[model samples]
Target: MKLCFQNDNICVYSLKDWVKLRKEYRIIGEYLGSSQATPTLPIKLLPEEAIFLINKNVAKLIQYPKLLVEPTDDCFKEYNKLQVDLQQAEQKIYKEYRKKELKPYIDKIVIAKQRKLNDSVSTSSVLNEELNRMKVTQENIIWPTLTEPLDCVKGESIEVPKSILMKRTTPTKILVFTDLWEKGYYVTCGKKFGGDFLVYAGDPIAFHAIHIIRCIEDPLKPLHTSELVAFGRLGTSVKKKSVLATKTNETVNYITINWLDL
Candidate 1:
């Protein structure tokens, strides 16, 4: 798998590898592409995710030079031409379909219009002309689904660098994630829930997250009362249990906090 380092995140550019990682390995990386379109190639992995994959020998970390290049005038022209050609081809096919499918409806419309006008206009000609000049609405246009796999970039493999290490995901966080993942739970970033990781009983798509995990790096450290209350409230509001996971030299421990309202 091509693990390209881009903008402090490890990215997988190959669609095949991304699908395999997500479906088989349960490594659900965030898709950084357009939200309007179905997710395609190029998914950015969190720091913890990249580290886990690297440690497990699932993917190698690499520094790829020339990751982005400026397109030339010819490239822009070719792209524009391709877009136009696709539009034309789709329009042509849809026009034929509309002519056939909408024939009865259009004929009825033409006949009614002629009757209202009390004229001898041919409905066939009118229907033909209307269908020929019909404009395809945005809803009628179908966007192509991109399922093709792209060529993976082979960059120079290097040891995990300091720059890739994020302050948000500490060693303890990784340990917590690894522990939960090894125990048959699907773990994902929990920034949305104001936690370190969200743990699911099974595949995330099939089951709702069961716990919002926050890792305490120091086993002896205690969370402030307000912080603990807030974390518990957040989990309650999101319909999940709040869990504080702390790691000692030998093992990791988890404590679930339940917020009760009187």
Candidate 2:
């Protein structure tokens, strides 16, 4: 089972799990790690989203009951030793690889230098010294590592009960979201669109949002005319339908609001 970690909040730390969730399940969660403007993983799942995944048996939520133990003095020493070892290993591999790549170039350079010396005042000792110096200069060249940080670190899964997951989000919001999701629409948080969710017919990136969905927990609750007009006008401006989603018993209902110029 794919495991999502629950720290301060529920999040999918693994890039593989996140890709599957978005591509397969159409669960597009917010990327909330380093560089929000230019987002990188791990992505954060909304409470409703987390609960939906749990209910569907798509993923298991794991909660760390206690904070990770702080590193001991010995641990720091071991880590520094490991870093030094890694640097040494990298340097050795880099030298071998670079030597092979730069061999032809170095040969060309050495030949040119020898030809220049031959034209001027060439001696066997002087030529040998020049070649040795060139080789040493080439060997001293340092290149940066191409390695990237690991996507996620695997840890022991501490299974959080389904009942506990249920407590994280409101039932009405889940019901509305699940209904839309089951209908094959891609849904993402619609705060920017001034709604609870932005519903797209296909991949959110490829298609324009079809609906700006606002979840209404109480179907019978009264909404002000101004609020309705604002939603409708905003939706029209963005070329999307404003939809109010609510649940009556177990059935979810959608009401579309259209703004008219008249």
Candidate 3:
């Protein structure tokens, strides 16, 4: 990612490295500020004066980072403070401008302003109603679901509740198979397929059964295997022309087990 600073100089760094540096340096202003150049100061100002000027400009640059991207706590806090300052400054500027440029023009125009103030409403009841409305709004807000669908497939056996699976309108079953003869079976399977089948398939029989079922059913369905496990199914103990095994250091190499060994 290219990080451009206030001086208009850009530095290229990996996203991870940039995040680390941003946290370490607390350079939220540099990241969020507008690309447009600011009015140049004619002479070198005192340190305090320079800081004040920079702070004002810094407020203008304050923006929240992408929600998907994680920023440090300090960066978030600084960004929030700068945002608040920017809003206040904007309001103040607008108020001054309106007073100077708009108030006189409005004053010259004849206007009949009728303010209809409600007298029947009690202040305490209004406050309570507003508070209740705010509470209801907060309660109704749906927070984002944190869990990723792919996360259910990546590493370790995931024991999904039968009840939950049954509740789905179209429940999908993922079956993973591995050859015991293959070296790094669990790692390879998990890396490729991910999920419960990789971890739970302890013996050749279980693995063969799962694979046989998958080979028969997978082609009939819309479901597809991950890129890592696209080599189709494998069998156990069966030695057919389709099956081949090479041994190196007592570990099995790319062995193609027959699909019919179900």
In lDDT terms, how accurate is model 1? Answer: 0.75
Which pairs clash in the backbone of model 3? none
Q: For each candidate in the order shown, give its overall lDDT on alpha carbons.
A: 0.75, 0.73, 0.30
lDDT by residue (tens digit), candidate 1, 1-262? 6577756767776778877887877888777654245655567787888778877888876764433446578776986676677768877887788778876687687777789989867877776777678564444544554333222324334554634655636888878778887887888888899988888888877999999998888878766899999999999998999999898885899999999999
| Candidate 3, lDDT over the whole model | 0.30
Best by TM-score: 1
Is candidate 1 or 3 superior in lDDT?
1
In terms of TM-score, how similar is model 2 to the real structure?
0.66
lDDT of 3 by residue, 1-262 (tens): 1221112222212345334323432221122222134311111111221222233342111111232246578776985676566555655555555445544444222221112342344444443333333221222322222222123222332222223322321111211122331222321122223221222223332443232222222233443444213334332322211222233343334334344534
Alpha carbon deviation, residue 211, candidate 1 (Å): 0.9
What are the models' TM-scores? 0.76, 0.66, 0.20
As for TM-score, the candidate ahead, 1 or 3, is: 1
Candidate 2 per-residue lDDT, tens place, 1-262, comes to 3545555466775667777888889998886665324566767777778878878888877755333456578777975676666666655665566666655566565667778767533344444444344332223433222122222334444776766666766788888888989999988889999999889999976998999999998777899999999999999999999999888888998899999997
